[model samples]
Target: MPLLWKTSILLAISHDSNILPAHLQPLPSRGGHIRWNWIGDEHLNKTTDIIYMNASVAADGTLTGVSDFRATKFNGVTWLKTHAGREGVFAFKGPKAFMSIPGIVLPQDLKTFTFEASYAPQGAQNAELIRSGDFRIAWKGDTLSIQNGANTYQGSIPAVPAGQWVQLGCVVKEGIPSLFVNGKAVALLPGQSQPLTSIGNATLIGSGYTGMMDELRVWKEARPATRLGRDISPTWADRLLYFHLPADTKRSMGEDKASWASQIAWIRSRLRNPADHMVRLGIAGGAWKDMLRDPKARQKFAGEIASIVNRYKLDGVDLDFEWIEGPYKGDPPARQWDNYADLAQRIRKAQPDMCFTISLHVVCYRMPKKGIDAVDYFTFQNYGPSSARYPFDDFTRSLAAFRKQGFPDSKIMLSVPFQGTGDAKADSVRLYSDIVAQHPNLPPTADTAEFTYPDGTKRKMTFNGPATIRKKCEYAKAQKLRGIMYWDMGGDVRTDARKGQTDYRHPKALLPVINEILKGRR
Candidate 1:
């Protein structure tokens, strides 16, 4: 429930018995009240296992929690009532609604435990998502920050438009704290041997939380990153159909709801392979953009991605952390790669079967073997203004360069754009289906095409037609690359008014060609 995108649905969906890890095999079903390991049972009354709210309120105003806890949603707080079939939903009225649990303060001798919850942020107004006086998670306008007494840190997670959700968890052992969001470990504060100072007041979910919450779990153990209750998800098979989505918060580009969420959902539910389930619908972009250079920022963003996949139940995650040195080159580029490696390592530990992927930007394309080791697959873009990977411009060079650099072609998915381009290597930039619609006479040869935008300006562009795509696919097969990929899901097709999504209009579009070439081959 904590958006454990690390989820397997825990059902016998696949016939392949050997694929699941030992922990994921067919198991007993336990309701929400399993007493995980309460070594402090003798001190039950002395112990402060208070439950403010376990992400849900029953029809009788009861919380589905463990023994020795009763969550009371005090002061006339209303439920969101739109839970999407989850375990719990708590809706707060800014500044008015707050839940508290008393006796959680540990005795001076205690030093280990876990705190976790699934929370969604719905606005910019200052409010605490969850906090004790000694530790707090809050949103100050567009940014999210955490505090432990006077020392505070902001998470690298990007700002979401009014209604986006994420999970947060923290494990404090001997006073050293490791924080997590959406199942990925984010930060480990310094001073492990010190005592965990208490919050003078009590454990509270107050200040300003304007969204639903669920699966509130706590454990009295020094749980390792691996045991962080990361729900497992299904795996992508040899054939991968991935989309690089921008975590576009504001829904820009004349779009409505988060780009392609509904579309991808449509694909997952509507389109299945008959043998396996549907495609392993994944997302990229957002949170990882500025994470390449800072340690805490990297940790914060790592959890952000994990949280997203968990919240959305994506099959996995794909990354595009582009800046190696970035503007001014102030940060060490090598360390940036290390941060990402840590991310993959931590998240994979929680959800080993989930597919993890990384993208290689052409200009500065180079990854340590370990970083590559962290992921299930590696993809390199061959299209851009550089005119390097585009078949219309010249397809041979980019693949050859990757080979020349000793890359494992078996792991590399040669990524291509599904749209046409112009300018000093790139421009006209319209969907492949749109290109066909505009010029019925446009041939499959690598020829220059003209595009007229709403501005009434025309630009000559080099387009990858059906013939070129087929050739590229054949070339990839001959070279034994992983597979061919388009830049995104929306770039190949035109928007459909009926479903408020896009439709595959032309059979000759490169997308169709890729699917055609890969059909039954894997």
Candidate 2:
């Protein structure tokens, strides 16, 4: 699993080939992985410098595939329990595990080429996961698509979620091939107009893989998704909190008991605050336009959010639909986005370990994508009206255009606005604690803030303070993304610097760098 970094163009071997390169040799696994096949697999010469490696050793040690490669044991692949400390391994029970790489060639000039990796699957078929000759890459069912001769790309592919650890990709020359989950490009598929001529002979990896896989590069050029490596979701590494509370847009919410004792004193001060990974605390509701297009109002809005989580024992709810992506305004288009994925599959059949989420919009439009993959997390509200500056390439090209439209930056998330949409021409949302309670010098550099209105018109405001929310939570924990959402907790309003305000608190400046880059994920 070696590739901590290195890819301006290429470099390979080491997702546990343990750095093989003396000519090559290492492949053996009946319970792990090793299907080998690259003996004369020509087609890797844009100034050739290949270093391929795919290791796995078990059935009684001593590597295996060495020359003109071709080994197989396939007990339906295995391995994947190591964490943070870094032991690069991943295999899946794919339809009887497979692999082959011989004569792999393709660059019949389709324009730009690319196909990075870090995948995770386990459902929906029309499988293949990877192939060479006809240049395939499957999952036609739950979506992660691509094909060659006579093309195959259905568009949006973000829900083939069997075990959920996406980072899959594709970038075939440009116009048509798009899908890329975790590193985020999300979906596009649709345009081939014909061009990619010579592609495979061999180069397959689990013809029907069910789950797990790691760092499988193959970039002829469009490369630029990077940020592989993920593993930390033991309920978000033990209690990654969520206090969203938006609902008060008027009624049917928490049906009252003084709003259920102020949401049980805001989930008991967010699990007794001072955050040592605050073990669970969700609520994020509002976006309730009569609970989207109706099926008995989405079964009475999932039975009033399952009776407010069995009447106040509440520990999770976040549906925040943010416009289920229908025809918008009062939504209705044939079941306003399939009745919110059938009300999150009946609220995951009534809270199967609740902690649901959904709040995307990086141009999602019609974005239901399997109803936010049936929940457990989803976010992307990537802010706006930042006067003029929020362009970190417009937030990484709207996260590579939401992974080209498939959406699965590992459960996805990136939202960014600690309040202050204010006067980017009267868009007005203001809440860097009321823009520092009337501009008392304000300038922690949210695109160089500014204020002067009352009609004197002199605006320019953004917001994110506290070192731009610790540099966007360290670029969403170095882009493995999946958690960093905060859209309106009253706009980061901790407020206390002697009332001159500006603390934008939200759990003391965003949970100490989101609990130090997610409890320090190795």
Candidate 3:
């Protein structure tokens, strides 16, 4: 009987070199050169001009990076079904396989830089984990080394165990670098501080290390050591890239995959109503405050946003502008508000067809009338605890206040809260979906949900159930308000629990309730 052997093999041959038969291979000649080639064509002409829409994009400035594999097909990385876990988390299994985030040119004027990701290694002792031009983070015999220009910083980190997840981070500030592992600082081999060379090539990950990575983030500001391992909030303004959630997998008008924009497209696809979707713009930090103070910066900012709106074929842009006045900026609150309105005017001038709107967070007196005129509509965020029922009196009073400020009833939108608050213990802020899943027999018209904790005590959470939602919609219609704006759709009893997935017609869902009341569809 003939001997049999079984194993898996990957083969690669040079296009310009000789091809050898599987059964026979030539031995290496003396002094012959050995070359390692990547699996994808490096010279492929691909455009990385497309912008990814994420929670960050909804609020912050323009960010350029690949949030999913679809954005990197130009560099030979395509979406594959074998990818496990949630969207945006990629699994790399081959040694020569790597993915590059295209069109990444490190801005030379950036004062600080930070890169971080959560990854699970797969026993590659010597492999490059991330590389961009001369900057590289690699593993050499279980030790991690970071290199930039002529400087190499090797940290005294423990042996990286193969199947466990580790949050790795590196921050470079004023030519000095710091390494963080799992939120703790690592002792580094000292070397002279040298400013990193600006990266002109694409940032590549998993060049040789076979692993799984998720929650990749990059920042133009070198985040302090305290915030190294903690997940950055979605609204952080300094963030250059935030690929943390499921919404990252899709584009604004991409026909290929699902995204926030795609979800809006999906809604319009099913409805006869000419619904328009606009990306929200706001920021959680001082970036916006500083930018608005300067006339030139504000103009450039508005133009960039208008360009994004045009490029993505979006309906328009919405301003969730908050934090206009703070002690950090000595300018009076009224002045900042004026600057904000001026920014709105600039944006409006750039794209006259854009449906400009704003989320009303300030008092009517502080809100600039000019800004109100520039916007097509405004959503009043009347947020408070609905201990047992929706605050009908407060809601009406807020609308009256806006009206006193010259806000038209037809241009005002009512805000609805889908998340539970007050009375519920342990998890006070529970999603409507979780509440519904806990009590199947609960009535959609009910205003409060009761839950029993492990301690045998029951607590009631007051949220806007279908009945409350319908009541608000009816009030909006009766008052001649523009429309109802749900605080968020993600917290509802979605047909699917994943982000960006919505089943608008679910009996207990708030959306269908609003539709029934406002659209007369019941």
Candidate 4:
């Protein structure tokens, strides 16, 4: 892999060894020897140029040590080392050093470039083995692509056998770049036309390059290839066309409803047409039941729910009542289920346009068939099946069974456990303040009774760091799942509070990852 343009600072050290002390012998007959040392004074002599050893000089004349040995010169004090060698004689012990060429040509502005090249496997670690610019072309699986702006480029080549290499090259000229795989042109696009600027920094090798790259080159002038490279192939464009559903806020409970409503409002405010994005509000079925017990409370709750729906302009409401001590328990409570159904009917009558979703435990699948038909969408809390000694596969199959029973994919939201503990006790409710004080690692536990690992590792794990969460969101998009809904927002907010204690402020770490996932999906 080679960057489309290369920039570097090359330092040429020259020394003639006749001025050495006669008694001071060279070590082990090395090819050449030069010794230079510097000390400081009360004040530096501005007239004397500072000598740097194994340092990369920045644009400001500041010497940045690229090697382990480095010190600064203050007043008259200095740190310097001797250099001895002809063009390529002395063995260099550190990174290659370079000197910036003032007023050199620049090929492109600071804009990012995406090039298309044949996907070639870069082996296990996917290290870049080719001599390219700061960038190297390497493959991870079977394919690779470079993306920038509105353009994307991709290429394919004969699969390289293990221990073999593949040749891939791309060059930009006149607002267009051509990609060559095995010396044949495969893709091309209008490369942003710009001046050929001097690459003033050391080439970062294998940093951005993923796969294997060899024989990489960059030229001030564009060279013609035997084949014409085109834009991202139609196949690649088709792959990018896929898309994620709106996030479901069904499990947001108590104060969580307000937080979720705020989140939805925040998202809604940014959209040109809020209706374009799906918004699901959570209606506490427990609250509704409490209202039934107290008629006055029912009226107040109904008014509050209606106000919330109007205030947030919600698209739908997800009925999430755990039904912990309801009549539906022990034996089928047709009356209790009827009350719940009637509440849904009332809300639907009030907001005819709004969608209604009912969240149920997997056991709800055993409810009378008519009870299941009342809600517009069915959300299955697929978590916690392990409590019954049921395999995760079994839980997944139960959700699949709903689909088999005429539930549309769009009408189903899978509720994943935010609390990753396979242990039921781990999900035991804790106040936000308590979590802030104790700072227990919560959820997505790697090992615990609440969480069971595929490989049987028993380590408790939190949801993966932000990077892993972003990857999971991407996977969700790829899988075309309806959307992801977690049990509650308080736990996550509390986790951030604990982190904020040490840092003096709550970190916006999770927001960025979430926003990235929501990009364009809005």
Candidate 5:
């Protein structure tokens, strides 16, 4: 699961019957064998068609798919288990080894589309990574090539380094085809006029590619070049198929079996008033300091940010400068606090109509007041030890620290963690969903849950349960704060099933608790 922050969760209803329901939206893509299960009478029939973005495999060797379609392994394509906390990767034993999937239909127009995957080559060789109908995505030695009828090209994409996990994507938007490697657009080919689909559209993955392929996805729409290849867990909405080629290994992030994009689309389609809810894109990166340090680049970058905000019709932008106190990579400027402030000011100037907010740790008290005043609100990262070791004390002390630093009370949003802190020497934070799934009868007020492993090692996870989350919401309301904030919607206990799968909203979920405390039940 990818980490996203939100100040609030609001609902709306869509009235139009003409719109295709979100779950019914076509996703002709491919990935691992994990399934995304949906709960609710309205979704029972649509669940079979849901498109999942995250990928995970079943450990029992049985291909368990939530969708009606299935993946068939052919010619010695085997599973390779990796170290604990990582998904089990697929191993292509020889040239003939591959995985075949039926029912992946590319758009008839083929004017725009995207095909992408993650692969680690055992050695350099000409290999076909994806083949279906007349479309062929292959690697001619280190160069990625595509052969779709006569509209074909080779070496347009930069040479892919051998023996490393590289994410490769081909995005054909508006008749022009571009190649993206590791999130950056590397090459482009002449436009094609023919349909990209074939009559018999079964997809074969990894014939002649003697390597591991994972996190595969195909989409009818060309993914935004600026947005592709950035996050491993991009939402699956218009995609045809999505698969993660490995099994869970007790990691903090759960499987990407559910169609988050479809769920959101369905929710949005049913909204009574769209203005009641909003979606903000979070922006953060180390390279941002350099862009902001120079005046010319800063203005241009700010404009680009605004373009994204306006073009997508996003409600706002959230600034998450993680390296505010940095001599990043031991570069010059030991503290880039001023640069961070400048960035906020620049983006604010560019996109004044859109809401602007920033997320900061307690160490950011020293950030210039100029930067502090540029945004609409401030979200304090109040759940961790550097803020305070004790739970309730941490919240209060962290707020006081920011208050002392002069952040306005009305613009302050208190933070809550749906995932547990690593009190049990856990390698990663434990999701609230996993905690409740493992301990269904655990007390709602109990903020800590301990588990014993097979080796008799005991570890305790500290997190906010329904009771704790409610208390925090109430506290924020009492303090007259702007609102409460949480790291993600994915971490809350959203399903009733105990298999630790699916993405449906359960009654005991944390968001509902927050809603009850903050807004009163509808």
Candidate 6:
């Protein structure tokens, strides 16, 4: 038997005076046999009309309906129903419907089910109107089949059609369930199955009935047909949980050289306890300059990073070096690139087991390919004016360009910005909260930068929200790309040159969302 989540009842009817009675009961605590009363009013009398009751149950049980006046008792250990009212009352009515409990003979377990009962259309009207317009059924797995009125049908999974009253049944036998329409086989499942147990709920019935259901039975047996009724896919929530880092930890450091060190500490703290998904520590841009300036400084930085690995520990290190001043600057000042390469090579040598990353700008025309090849992962900073205009195409082309330079997809990282900027003056150089407090004209979207082209045309660039980021991540995954990294972590903070004070705003805002996307859970 498979684990069951929850059971529900759906009733659709048109008549005004129709009353559907419901009886609620408790599920049995221990595994054992149980019994219940299956009684209903016998006043039902209508021609060419179908009537039935629907109930939710857990565990396997029998429902025996006894006609008191007629002294006729129909006992069904599986699933049962009728087309008209009772046998002989309506000759034009369809069959005396009784469906068997889907056999439970498979080897695996089942998870979900959908069932429905419906009324099939008659003649040209039936063909044009859509067959099985009204039907009712319940399932423990994917699909169900049922019959009602003058028509029979392959019922819809999860929901039956309106206007027809048909009893639908679904059961999980081992790992499969079979669906039957009007006692005839309709669908089968070789793998999917859901355990059928008792759900303490009343059975639904008649006229107002979207579709009639009565003498509905649930058993430990499997119904193969139900698995064909619907599709089952895993949800984002189902992937499991992973923590990136604390808000304060991610925010406390700014775009300064020390932010990388702080971030390393933060990542170590997060990795103290392992989770299902992997955790990453990103050292923002500008930090590389601090590491390269002095030999003593370089050693200290490396030592601290190694301590981070030894202490809280980490999966990898992300290199975000925005120090390259652009192509027009010519040759990139030589020593800067050398120092950058040295830092990367050292990190790789020290932590060969870790993922060594370097954040490089996306100017393929000007970027030094040799410097990029030193790191385990090279994240291209796809922000600024060049990226805003041709976002997707430009990024794809740039990735291709990197591959042409001998950089594999697994070695590349896509760095997108979460903050936006427009006018240098209007842009909040500080935290968002501080920006809000100081600059009254600044809008939530104003912080994003807007770039101006050589032709004097301007385009606005905003940080992508979770949805867009998720799509981008998916695209990257599909391309077999390495991973994603972002620009300066503290770009949202407000800085005051006069007082020399800084405030990190929205530090926790985007990191979690990014982590979620990377883990394929967003």
Find the candidate with the highest lDDT and give its number.
Answer: 5
Instruction: Give the Å error, residue 262, model 3.
Output: 9.4
TM-score of each: 0.48, 0.28, 0.62, 0.34, 0.53, 0.35
- Measured with C-alpha atoms, the lDDT of residue 331 in candidate 5 is 48
Show where candidate 2 strays beyond 4 Å.
1-76, 80-87, 91-95, 98-127, 130-168, 171-212, 215-295, 298-300, 307-418, 425-459, 462-522
Per-residue CA lDDT of model 1 for 212-279, tens digit only, reads 55545554456556655454211111011111111122122111111134333333343223223312
What TM-score does candidate 6 get on C-alpha atoms? Answer: 0.35
Candidate 6 lDDT tens digits, 1-522: 110000000000011112111111111100000011111111111000111111111111111110111101222211222334421111111122221112121111223232322332111111110111222333322333232222233434433343333434444333234465544554642332223233222112221212223322222234345332222112111111010111112232111111223322322233223232132343442234444655555555555555555554455544434645543224444566665566566666666686455546666322345555656555565655432522566667777777776677766666545444442332322222223333445443343444443346565544444445456555665676665544323222333312222232233233334444444321
Ranking by lDDT: 5, 3, 1, 2, 6, 4
Q: Output the better candidate (4/6) by lDDT.
A: 6
lDDT of each: 0.45, 0.44, 0.51, 0.33, 0.54, 0.33
Candidate 6: C-alpha lDDT: 0.33
Question: Between candidates 1 and 6, which one is better according to TM-score?
Answer: 1
Error of 3 at 409 (Å): 2.0
lDDT minimum window of 10 residues, candidate 1: 1-10
For 1-522, candidate 5 gives per-residue lDDT tens digits of 111123211110011111111111111233211233222322222111121222211222111222322354466566656622236666676577777766443444556777777777777656778776667777767676776656876555545555567778888776556788887867555444345556375767787878776656666577876655454331344334433323333231113323332333444454454454454444444355555556666666677668756765666655555545646555444346676677679889999988677767766545678887887767666555221332776777777887887887776776776567645443435556667777888887888778543456667667777777777767777777766666443455645433333343565566556545554541
RMSD of each predicted structure: 18.6, 23.3, 17.2, 31.6, 15.5, 29.2
lDDT of 2 by residue, 479-512 (tens): 7756555443223333442222223223334323
Residue 141 shift from truth in candidate 4, angstroms: 81
Model 4 spans with C-alpha error above 4 angstroms:
1-281, 285-304, 324-331, 365-374, 384-395, 404-406, 422-481, 488-522
How does model 2 fare in lDDT?
0.44
Candidate 6 lDDT for residue 89 = 15
- Model 5 TM-score is 0.53
Candidate 4 lDDT, 1-522, residue by residue in tens? 100000000000001110000001011111001110011110011001111111122222221221111111111111112112111111111112111112211233413233322222334333222112233333334443433224444454445664344545555554344566666766443333223222443222232233322212223334345322332121211121100011122121111111222333333443344333344444332234444443344344444445555765554555456553446324345555555555555555556676555666766543334544555555566554243422344445765676766665554544433233333354432222223233345332222323333355444322333444455445534445454333322222332332221111234222223333534211
The local distance difference test score of model 1 is 0.45
